[model samples]
Target: MTSTAEEEVLIGFGTTCYYLVFRLMITTTGYGLAALGSLIVIRTINLDNAKSWREPKSIQLLCSLIILSCFTGYIILQAAHAFIAIKAGIGGNPVSLAMLLTDDIQLFLNATIILVGDFVICWRAWVLLSEDKFWRYFLALAMIINIGINIADPVYDVPNMKSELKGVFNVLDWLSVACSSIVNLIATSLIAWKAWSHYRLSRETSIWRVGRQSHRARWVLLLIIESGALFLVLQLFALATETGSSFSGSTFDKDLTFVTVAKVAGSLWNVSAALYPLAIIILVHTNNSPIEETYYAGTQHTPVSLTLLGNMRHSASGGGESTAF
Candidate 1:
């Protein structure tokens, strides 16, 4: 009901963007729910397999299920954010919408979960790599930083805090993004390189070939992780442009463009994570019949005659070799 053309135009644009965002959010939420279903199916299969084999553990399958659970929660949170974004179309004010965006406990919880997941990935990578103590310490530091950010977010998010601390927290948040990304990029690259090295070292050995397969699988995982990292950079850039331009009194067109770009980038970032499982599926093959084969090769461990000798020793010792299990 505004009389001004500028007000009408801005409202129109905001409504359009909000609609687009809402659509994407719904799509993302559906995909996440589907992922959760898929994980449930996978978990059932793993549980059945373990039951049949009488095996007590399936670590890989367990990890996948956990990731799926987190992703499911993420999708729900995204849907909530989408609702907030769309609230603007129904005569919601910008500042009110901003407040709504920050008001959700779910948003903060989701962000924290994501941050913790990244830390877990980094720490696990270091443990697998047998990396120096410094890597673990660095991971700890990153986790602490992330926790600090989460704690400070509420305090700094008071009314008009956007005008007060936008620059400071935006920079800090972006820095956190950068730090996590660099850690993953470096760790995954190193893992890929090491895996490739093993592949090159032994070409003809079938059993040792599993090690190479593991390497390939790991390489694929690394690529997915790195793609997510690159997307984070895009997100940070978009955030900077969108929020930064607002404070600078940029043109309406520029503001619209920046916000649209940021929305697209954020959608891509979410979709990228969802697609990681497809990457693993592509990397797997008939040659890599056993799930462990690729991981074995990637681990720099070469199966040898010593395995046979150890088996014989287990039989000779008559204790069923507790180490093997």
Candidate 2:
């Protein structure tokens, strides 16, 4: 039988291997999905009759490209870091290993991706609520708070940082998650409300008209909810992992599960965050079916005035303005 020390070493080695494989798989898969999503978005934009290279849709495409590039950079860095750790051996000091894994570069990239994601979501919220100052101000405030917190996060990344500082770091991380969740939740609610309002107005116009518009409005609402739900779930998972690891102390064996969970959740979060905007763009472009035109056209005959917000800006001819789905 192997000695106790030998068995412990084996366990550590096994854990390290598991981490590397898991990271590699998730990172690669996530990146591939983001790439595919980006391509679809670009293709959809190209096919759009109403949008042009000089339009706001083009700007959104640019933003998506930038976000995806950042995510790619982050994954590359993470892969390198994991390899280095494998070479260093997991038998080293757990605290130092943890600190190395959560290095300055990684934190910076994460904060950057998250900040961009927050901006995209908030921008959408602003466009949707441009007419309503209350929601616009509320979302603006949330974005400001989230951005400030994200910018301040990198400062606490010192080598062998103090326990008090670590506590502060954890607090900042949790605060960011909380603020982001609030922003997403509020933004999604507002968008859904607007879609519901449009649907209601369509129903009053004509049954056949409402049937066409209802399908398109439902799709828009679904996309918004899906995106928001994705972020909220990932953020909650990260928050739980971080909280658990922080309270678990320096025991590597005890903290391994928490750390692993956090890493996986983070990988998925980065990819999903990048893809979120691209997915939105593609969905909006695909939603330009005859149903949309019918819905908008029917609105002209109805006494009710429906204001379509965001990328759905179309000409006011008999057809209602095209809405960004």
Candidate 3:
């Protein structure tokens, strides 16, 4: 079918918006990579100081490095493929099934990134709530379910990329989003609760006579909550955009606006997911202080103590050595 003048104008606008979003994603990806790189360096230094490669902490750092490397590589490759496809005249053209397949691949990569992110957050929750097996099992179950949904999505979506099946795909996609959102919300709440509980316990026991140590612990907790909240807000925005596009599917039959919006939302969501962990690592790094470490040394392990915040050595005298989260 031939395009109307109005439809042509809309397509042009959609294409412009897509490219703008594309540029934004690239910029965000660059920042994310830089942050990840710095984290790797800092972590490596910490590992060297610890002088033990066999420790669980060292293994965790190694795994994190590997995941960040893979995530960065995938983002670059997907961005390049997107640029090439658009240059080959596939931009804003949803009817091009091959281009659509490329998008599906990107979606799969995004799901992988999100899976890694979810695992990281869940792991943090597990450590913070180490004594609570119920919360640990709950978070583990949620992470598993979320990962299952994410893995199932691309498998179901790629094969059924038909106009008639768009709604079905939307349902599957949103199902995954809903699972992830729930997991994030629950985990963040648990972390916040643990932090607050620890603060209250320390106050009641007079374990923290000086307000400075308690203040630092609260700062760490606030940083963690803020980071989680930021990521959740971005995911919610992505979900909103997807819902809007799904609802407007029929009105914009050409699918330009919907396609552009979906791509933008997906890209932003992945970028935010990648940035969240990096932000947490950097925040912990910057907040590390020699004075704080000395003061915290000889401190008993508490539920929401700095030890739970990062990797720290427990002194023989029930204190803590300098650590990074």
**Using TM-score as the measure, which candidate wins?**
2
Which residue pairs does candidate 1 place in steric collision?
211-297, 213-294, 214-294, 214-295, 215-298
- Model 1, 41-68: lDDT tens per residue? 4634334424433221244344445556
TM-score of 2: 0.74
Relative to the true structure, how large is the alpha-carbon lDDT of every model? 0.48, 0.63, 0.61
The Cα error of candidate 1 at residue 281, in Å, is 12
Q: Tell how far residue 221 is off in model 2, in angstroms.
A: 7.9
Lowest lDDT sum, 10 consecutive residues, model 2, at: 295-304
> Residue 325 in model 2: shift from native, Å?
12
Off by over 4 Å in 3: 1-10, 13-45, 48-55, 90-101, 162-169, 207-227, 248-265, 282-325
TM-score of candidate 1 to 2 decimals = 0.59
Q: Would you list the rank order by TM-score, best first?
A: 2, 3, 1
What TM-score does each of the candidates earn? 0.59, 0.74, 0.70
RMSD of each: 7.9, 6.4, 6.4
1-325, model 2: which lDDT tens digit per residue?
A: 9999989987987787788779778878878888888777777655244345545556667777777788788778778767766766654644454546546677787778778777776766555564699889988888888788777766665443434443333566566666766777787677666656555644544333335554766665555543466666776776666555655354531766668877787667766767676665565556632223222221133211243422233333335544433
Backbone collisions counted per model:
5, 5, 4
